[model samples]
Target: MKFKIRKSKILRNLFIAIGLLSLGNLISVYLIFNTAGVEAKVTRLLVKLLNVNLEANLPTYFSSLVLLADAILLALIAYGNRAIGGRFWHWIGLSLIFVFISLDEMIQIHEQLRAPMEALFNTSGLLYFAWFIPYMAIVVILGIAYFKFMMSLPKKILKLFILAGVVFVSGAVGMEMLGGLHAEVHGEDTLTYALMYSFEEFMEMSGGAIFFYALIVYIEMNFEKLRLRFKPKKKKKKIKKIKKNLIEA
Candidate 1:
């Protein structure tokens, strides 16, 4: 059977998912702060589900989903550019980057890079995070390269896209800086560390949610009838010959 994928439905589901995740994260925080005993077990479980903890499960999965969404957007843009006879391979490049990002999100490539980068840089403060050094540089280069392209986009799309980027970066890099300093002094086991990490997770997911909504809106605006479905063709029934029945009659 064929099923249509409506933007409205997608929007609703995405919003709901983000809301529920946020609520779960908040509950975890509350439990951590206020309760003890069996509640601690429940809180730990919730934290795992909500991406507040260091476990590479919920957060990784959610980040992968976000990267996949970004990759889809880039793919659509690449198609649109090609349709318009535009020669911009940059969109394809961005899509490929998102693919890598999605994989990296799940596997924690940036985390693994931390040690090497720290050893090389021998820095402190925000730069002590190490990964952020190269990451910020890449962001700068990409921002410069895509400045004109971003400016050329429709106002609504441009605004949403930029908002998504700013939100994501604020959490990923900005909060990371703060968290790094805090960890440097207090270690990662403190309540403050958990709180900062919780906030970071929320921001990352929130950014992804916003970007997903924006992409859906843009696609719906451009191609109002877009849908994804799978339908199986019905088999034809074989007809039996009836000549003998007519002769008998």
Candidate 2:
């Protein structure tokens, strides 16, 4: 009914996973570029699955799953905070945001905005992707809206949250802008572009992992224990007897 998780162990595993995924992406890129003659079908499939720059692949799924994990953690924290009469809604909002982000990661909702945004703004260079504009606006709005809530957090949590945000945004927006510019100039088929995007994905994944760790730490600090309980089903005969006794009384 109760489960105890070692936070350090979890953090270590997360870092290991991130490192392996990044290495996989790098190897895939290298193999794709260096391999001459027809590649084996399985090798080609592995390359496609491991490439971090490509969509609908292992890296993308991992990222989405990471975001989903963050959302679940945030939701649990929100429930815990609500029970304690703390900042319940703020945690809920974060959970919701992560939920949307997880879905977006899988479906590439932001990517869908690129072409229309480019057409509407006639943007180029750093804005070649054109998706980060709206995303940046949303970030600004969220920053403003959550300013007070962020300020109210404990210094440790506040610092971790800021660090995670910077890391994630630097990759998701900052590197994206630079990558867009690079793609606009040299095009996407280059090794340089692959490396840039790979780095970007790495940052995003790392940020999510850090944020997940932070949430786990927060829960450990604020709650006595994290656990789950399942209730056993009542016997029908017992229920009927209890009902009859109640009626007689």
Candidate 3:
């Protein structure tokens, strides 16, 4: 027997999930900014990434810039995908795009979150994900646009999202295994650390992926507007021609 999901409940669950995730993330960010102890560490990382040696604070321009660019790129992507078929291959392609971005996000989160922990141990050469926060924000913003606006995704998008998760986790493990062997020989915690990093990244990205999938599904469920925008050549003229041929026949 085939499984069928209800549209209304899916829509409800999706929005609820997005709301909770966004709220939780905002609270965490508020804490990061408000607390002095975490604030300094976060500032130091930001300064280093921006390469600002002067005694000035970080600018809000970073966010505005990312948002501006993300808006453009997202609009382009949505417009570009207006008429894409909702098929297995198409699903795979979309999944890969999300996965590629998702993996990059995982790597970035690992770098960013690991910095503070590394700093706790006084690891001097450690680096932080200063600009990465903004970059990730763009990804999230685009994700929101993808969900809210662009409504064209494969059937069973949830399954495709899960497939991407499996692939990413497998790749992460494989890379770490090779490094882990080396770490064992060198008497280092590199493998363990890498695993910890991957896990952290996975946690952060996994929720975003689900939100992303739900967004795609939402858009797909409303594909008529999406279709009219996409299928320009198959409009009135084509219908007129078909009618003329039928009348003659």
Candidate 4:
């Protein structure tokens, strides 16, 4: 049976998936703070990694910047690929899984912090975590779907995910390069310094995760298609050759 995907449905699904994933992430955070707790060493490391000075609103500003960039990225992606909008639901579902996994990672990495450890979120943090829900959710569901159904999808779409990963990596490098220039001239605490730049780091991690696994998903989804189109055709041709030889003999 041919699978038909509606564009409107795609948009709706994307929104929903994003919502679910975001919810899961927040829930994880809530649970970690409430139950798991973080390590003291990890807490120090996060503060240092985040580079939050007492004077500057760096954490808040940095978070805002990261999320803003992420949102812009999602918009750009949705614009370029209609599938992002149509398969929006799948993406959203995947996002929930993604967030939970990442959240779990965070919890695992920091099991010694105070219950209300300073997460240091801002407007951008909200945005980053918010849209992040869908990205993570879609990936999670697809991962399971591969093992469960394993329907072969198209190569073009698969390539798109790889391309998307490459593009995102490129953007991260660009951000780092740009930030580096400013840091060298401005100083360590300057906005250009990598330590003070959550925007670039967040993109590197979040975008990287999406595209890296996206490539995996794309390949798994299209594995059957590639086999059918290439391998199956060769099998048919060999059968035809054998039949002709038998007839001639």
Candidate 5:
């Protein structure tokens, strides 16, 4: 059997999803802040489901699924490159990183570090959410280690990868740092903080979608068509019974 996928279609759909999610988040924020009277039960439910700032919601699930998709794509590319043996480890390493990131996105493992890191470093202001410190260090080390691998990739892929990384980091770390500063001073229950987090989530989702599109393009360029087939096992003939009957005769 054969299956065909359009890279552009996937990209378009991804952007559409991101746009809808962003709109939903904005609506939830407006309903929460702008509405003066008591909110309806349905409105509260909508806020719970659509709020980008809240965890275990639609936005969180989408982000986690996007990262998981990236991990799967990276693993597929790594498997394809394994035959040629060039930068196989690099591809696999990236796959593992995405896998961890996907899990962290869902479970928020990094959030656990915030308290310990703050206590250890006496962090405040932009560093109020101190979990990013360790993550930033890891990113720097990985970047240094993967410098050669990045340079070796095709120009188109290199550019896409860098763009994805920039967008993701800007949201996951940069805007997060700014949000932390705002949160520390004025607290988390403010319109500005909500908007900051909403933008941050949007950027993160956009980055993942971009990277997923890049992987689809890469697969199309390098692997051509991905296919799957199924075949039934053959059965052996029963000759022993016939031979025994002939000998008895």
Candidate 6:
């Protein structure tokens, strides 16, 4: 039997996962606010799992997984670009960026830089996190460089890709700014901080889900069919005596 998966089917499953994860993050935030006696431990665990509370936890792991998936899909698309006599290196560069992001997510590399950034900037406003400076610059550069390529994409995919970038950056950068300001003023232990983090994580995951869907659709549209099949079971047969007798006859 063959296993057939349409692009829309894959996208639906990704969207469902994104929705569930978003709900989980929201619940985690609620628990943080309602932490009572016995519920305090549960709340702590949920916070650790759902936000940037700690390293090597659920949210970080899930983010890494999504980024890694994005990197793989981008790499595959790069190969497709090569096959079609397009700018394969450009796609490869984007894929490498995603890979770096995946690694950063798993290792919490950016979090480590926060202290040095704070010291260097000598400010606690938007630039408290110095990484955003370079990050935003890179984003702008990539946007300008790929503007035409993005325009060349099919309208549906182009729209989805742009939407995904906007959502992801809004969370990664926009919410980050808000959280940093709050933490600078009220410390990082407030309900507001937690809520902001929850929204940031949700947006990141949702953006990844959208990007994954777009990439799947792109591959399905451009490449040959994708399917899976299991090998049929073989049956043992008796000796071929009947066949030999018929030949002799």
Task: Please name the candidate that would achieve the greatest TM-score relative to the true structure.
Answer: 2
Better of 2 and 4 by lDDT: 2
User: Sort by TM-score, best first: what order?
Assistant: 2, 5, 6, 1, 4, 3
TM-score-wise, the better of 2 and 6 is 2
Q: Arrange candidates by lDDT, highest first: which order?
A: 5, 2, 6, 1, 3, 4
TM-score of 1: 0.77
lDDT of 4 by residue, 175-248 (tens): 54555456446654442353334444344444534443343444344332231122567888899999999999
**Can you write out model 1's per-residue Cα lDDT over 63-159, one digit (the tens) per residue?**
6887788888878766665655774487898888788778776777788879989999897776667887888898899999988888887899899
**Candidate with best lDDT:** 5
Per-prediction TM-score, please?
0.77, 0.89, 0.28, 0.30, 0.88, 0.80
| True-structure Cα RMSD, model 1 | 6.6
Off by over 4 Å in 6: 1-4, 38-46, 225-249
Question: In candidate 6, what are the lDDT values of residues 227-248, reduced to their tens digit?
Answer: 3223333321233666677889
Residue 151 shift from truth in candidate 1, angstroms: 1.3
The TM-score measured for candidate 4 stands at 0.30
Q: How many angstroms is residue 131 displaced in model 3 relative to the true structure, after the best TM-score fit? A: 6.6
Clashes by residue pair, model 3: 147-215, 151-219, 151-220
Residues 1-249 of candidate 5 have per-residue lDDT tens digits of: 122588889889999999999999999999889877537888889899999878899999999999999999898888777644545889899999999999999989999999999999999999999999999999999999999999998899999999999999999999999999999999998999999999999999999999998887777777654443233233212466667789999
Query: Residue 124 in candidate 6 has what lDDT?
Result: 71
Model 2 lDDT per residue over 117-144, tens place: 9999999988899988889999999999
lDDT of 2: 0.88
RMSD of each: 6.6, 3.3, 18.2, 17.2, 4.5, 6.8
lDDT of 3 by residue, 1-249 (tens): 112456467446644643453444334344434557755776555433332111121211222222233333334335435445423333334454554553443243444544564446433211222323344465566567556223454456555545544544443443334434445455343434434333433343333444444444544554434423445666978999999999999
Q: Residue 233 lDDT in model 3?
A: 68
Cα error, candidate 1, residue 35 (Å): 6.4
Q: Model 6 misses residue 201 by how many Å?
A: 0.6
